[model samples]
Target: MVQKVVIIGAGPAGLLLAHYLLRRCNYNIDIYERRRDPRLTDISSDRTFPISLQKRGRKAIQAIAGLEEAIAAQSVFCEGTILYGKKGKLRQIPRQNPVLTIDRNRLVSILLKHLNETSSPNQVKVHFNCECTAVDGTAKTVTLHPKEGDSFTADYDLLVGADGARSQVREYLAHNAGFTCSQNYVPDAYKSVFLSRLNPSAGVELEPNKIHVYNLNNQARMLMVPQPGDQLHGVIIFGAENNPLEGLSTKEEVHTFCQEKFPIFGQLMSLEEAEALLKRPVARVLTVRCDRFHEGDSMLLIGDAAHAVSPSIGQGCNSSLEDVLILGQLLEQYGDDWDQVLPKFSEQRVPDAHALRELSDYTFPRQKFLVVEFFLRTMVKRLFHRWFPDWVKPFVFDLVLDTDLPYSQVLSLSQGWINKVKRSST
Candidate 1:
């Protein structure tokens, strides 16, 4: 019998899963995306600047097809991250494969091309502009709302829900299939703006191979990622108890806020110009997690849908892509045994998912302001950087950046070692 799989969302996870399954297992697959085909036109005008893809995310893309070169062409290799401490001290943490920054649109374009070339040109399909209105895990069926004003239904042997934060698949599994789930939205807000050079020939301001971060130490955090040539993309994230951007109505108010809080803005952007451009509202950063990632024999959720981490650690995209690779491996091991594989994938991934959830929540306060806490943290970080080897920083960074490690196992081993060190100190 020919088995069929229905994947929700056309993001990295969903698209990669489709390709891997098609390559290894002959599962008839269909990808349903709510947005229009991004390749046909520019659909990211409303979106913030492009997201950064880490080594892990790059690795996942490589697994599907020999796309490393294609993706590398558009990406700027980030050499190291610049961390600004409380007293205006700048520390550069270097890495071997520094995170690579790529335009979100360009990466998707490459993935779409791979999908087109790899998929069954005649039979396999990618349903663009088709919204997943409903899903039934018990019946193993999905209903999609087409752009043409029609509803269509499809049955599947398996359903992979990579639909993102507010996932309809998750809702269906919890409400209809008796699965336990929880979602937490953090209090951080983010806004992105483009900083372009007036003279096209002026040349790039910073090295193309670095992820630039200007940490104001709780005043306001700013990150600038260099694009292809002279253009730079900047994002500002701040705490918002009641949506911090709500009251900043006019260009003057926005300008005042930027000038008062973000000193780096003046360096890279004209205050008046930035305020005028960002008269719109800021974007909210939400963290979502589910206690259980699967239901019975038919359904499972991955990526932001199952575990949406805050971008403070910059692991959201990397972790989402990792979910694809891990889940793909599991399916290969337990092929056709949906009854056994669904439960095992959930159990295997739950620990790491929970660890990432707590880490995402933990990073919020580092960005939040508090005088005593800030000073204490700065002292601790300084000590760590002084005594620890260059390799240790990224390992600590990995505790958040990489979520494939079993969270509980890592924590247990870490704690045991910490206890042994304490005993020797006494």
Candidate 2:
């Protein structure tokens, strides 16, 4: 029997899930996204940022044949990070493994392209500019609002909510089912920033294979990564209450502000970018935590919808992709029987998701003193762990980035540091 699988939100998780299910050859997949097709849109018009994929996320992409290579072609492989301090002072932290960084929209385009080229129209269909407004578990149907037409309902043998943090399916489960959920806005907000990697006349060029970072104080910071076209893309992150760009009324003021505060990037920024920066809206991250990810045998949530965390540690997408990977594994184990897969997935993943929230929230300290300790600990741990192999585990950041250790284990090993940071925040 062919199951009709309806996936909401054609982001990484949904599209990737389609790829996995299509391999089963017994499921017809339909993905509905609230936004327009990224492949057909102007990349610059989209308010998106770069995503850094390390081991966990990359392993998931590797499972789908040729997908990793497609993504790698459009990505920049970064070996280390350069941190800029006041007066051009800097620090470099090199990584043992290079990180693959790609713009979020570009990643989506590649995934969508692969889906379209490999799957027949009858096997898979993607509907953009359509939003999932409601779900009826008993009726096995979902209500969708299309951009150009009246709202309609469609039936599904299985429904997966990869709709992101503000998911209507998750909302329905919380209200109609017994799912427990909590949501809070992180204290930080950010604006997408774009700049050329090189400024020839100024003789300023950031390393093409490195991630660039600058801190204008604890309240404001910028993290940029190189893209394929000599482009540097990142975000200017600030405390919600302390947006440095708030008082700048004109593009010239914006330019002056960047020049004074972040001179290296300021030299690379164009007047047009400054004007666009002035007009760009501030974006706040909303973190979601749910007790479990599945409501019943046929309804499930993954990715940001299930466990959205702060991108502070750069595991948001990594973990989301890993969720799809794990689901694929469970389906294999349970012979594609969702009745057995959904509950087991929740039972296995909920703890890791909760632990990941802790790691993501408190891994990076806010206090200046702790920040120093953080770098010191990270450096010492890496060195000592290399020498003493079994004696010292790498610090939280290293363990998270450099290994595929389950997030729960990583949290357990670094509980002391997590506790210290948590206390300092209070």
Candidate 3:
């Protein structure tokens, strides 16, 4: 008998899981998404930022064979990051390995296209603009409100919620089932930003192989990554309660502000981009910390729906993709028995998720003094570790970005500094 699987949200986690499951011919999967079909819409309409995938996230996509190559064709690999300051001072931070970066929507489009090319409608179905509104665990059914039709209920032998931080399936498990969950808005919010890679008259251009950042202050910053066609795409992140772009009514005003605060990017910014910036919605990030990821044998949550963390460290998407990888492993280990796989996944992933929150929140120091020390420590650690590899570990940020070491181990090694960061903020 074929097991029917229903996955909510066609985001990275959901779509990737579909690929993983479809490889095993016994499962039929259906994915529901609230947004319009990404391939049919303009990329900018999606309001997505660039996602940097390291080994942890890459390994997941590589398992499917050819998926990683497809994504790499559309991605930009950066070997380092450049920090821009208000006074035009620049600091370059280099990474040992190049990280693959791609706009989130572009990544999704590639995934969806590959998913279609590989899987048939009989095996897997992706429904867009269909929102899941409720889950009935005992009935083994989910109710979805589609854009063109009346609400409907579909039954599933197994239900997986990869819907993300604001997940409806997770809500059902917590409020109706016995799952305990909590959600909080992170201190920062962001608006999508775009810039050209060149300015002919000014003769200014950003490095094509680097992630560029401009810190407006302690309250706001812009982080942009180079795209394939002489474009820069990223976000203007700011304190959620304090919007730096407040009171700016015109496109020229927004343009002037960027030119003054981030002169280089400002020179590259176009009037059209400035207009988009003025009208784009500000999106706040919500972090989800759940006591458990699964409720009984029939239902489970993965990715942001399981453990959404702050993008402060760029691990939200990485960890989300990693969740699919972890679950795929457990499925193989348990011989496709979800009853055994669910509990083991919770036992293995819950601690790592909790530890990830700690790592994400404190990996970068918040204070001016500690921020300075952060650079010093990272440089000294890199040099020291080269001389005596066994005695010293790389910096926490390095471990999180550059390696696939478990988050639990990384937290254990960096807890002292993490504690200090939390304390200073308090």
Q: In candidate 1, residue 106 scores what lDDT?
A: 64
Per-residue CA lDDT of candidate 3, range 171-227, in tens?
Answer: 998898878899999999999997888898999978999999988778888899999
Report lDDT per candidate.
Answer: 0.68, 0.94, 0.91
For model 1, name the residue pairs that clash. none
Q: Which tens-of-lDDT digit does each residue in 1-426 have in candidate 2?
A: 999999999998888899899888999989999999999987768879999999999999999889999999999999999999998898998988899999999999999999888899999999999999889999999999999989999999999999999999999999989999999999999999999999999999899999999998777999999999999999999999999999999999999999999998999999999999999999999999999999678999999999999999999999999999999999999999999999999999999999999999999998989999999999999999999999999999999998999999999999999999999999
Model 1: lDDT equals: 0.68
lDDT of residue 161 for candidate 1: 91
Candidate 2 at 321: error in angstroms? 0.3
The lDDT leader among the candidates is 2
* Pairwise lDDT winner, candidates 1 and 2: 2
- Give the C-alpha miss distance for residue 246 in model 2, angstroms: 1.6
Total clashes, candidate 2?
0
Model 3, CA-based lDDT = 0.91
